[model samples]
Target: MKKRWVLLVIVAFVAVGCAEPLTKTQKGAGIGTAIGAAAGAGLGQAIGRDTESTLIGAGIGAAVGALAGGSIGRYMDNQEATMRNQLAGVESASIQRNADMLAVTFKSDFWFDINSATLKPGAYTELQRVS
Candidate 1:
């Protein structure tokens, strides 16, 4: 069993190393799979000493985690596209996404008056609609 596990690991490493570069979603899934496998192995060992239990746990964890991670990437892609379209012709705001988080940044010059912390007059209405 230990040899089998070692062989599996070697095979997996070789396969991935020989493969083409992964996309963002694929990278997310790979990260998820690693995390999930570790968690599953820990849980499996705590519950039982058998390989079957470990494999089952790992499978379930990988499936759930991969789906979640990949879906999040896809969702971010969709949102970024939407944001780009929505902000078209409006250069003051920009949207950025990395992994699971999204950020929308607005140029301070557009919202604040010079040398003042207070918002410029009529800024509230446009900002409200954007938000």
Candidate 2:
């Protein structure tokens, strides 16, 4: 029974490790924005200001921030896809679309030189065209 429990625990740990981890930047931005918004609104209201106006301002600020962040995130994703495709050496690429964004992943060995960060000129040009 002890051996079985040990094996189960090992398997569970391995499964957890295999799961994708959130990047530190993502975690930091999400937590920071939430905390900042709450703090800003609370401070605004504590100064004998209009509560409704404070809340509305916070809501508008959050919406604009979210939109800007999403655009920047998509641009970064495109850059990553370009790099991956250049390194992948594949003939064609596939895109996975989410509700508001797309993920492009490729398969092929022709995309990059071994252990090299520099992309082929052709690959760079192609990626530019796609973007």
Give the per-residue lDDT digits (tens) of candidate 2, residues 40-92.
57655765489886786566555555555555555656666665656464355
Name the weakest run of 10 consecutive residues (lDDT summed) in model 1: 94-103
lDDT of 1 by residue, 1-131 (tens): 99999999999999979999666677777778878877887788678788988888888778777887787656656776777777665677887765456678889999998899999877787676566
User: Mind sharing the TM-score for model 2?
Assistant: 0.40
* Structural similarity to truth (TM-score) of each candidate: 0.62, 0.40
lDDT of 1: 0.78
lDDT of 2: 0.61
In model 1, residue pairs whose N, Cα or C atoms come closer than 3 Å (at least 3 residues apart or on different chains), thus clashing, are none
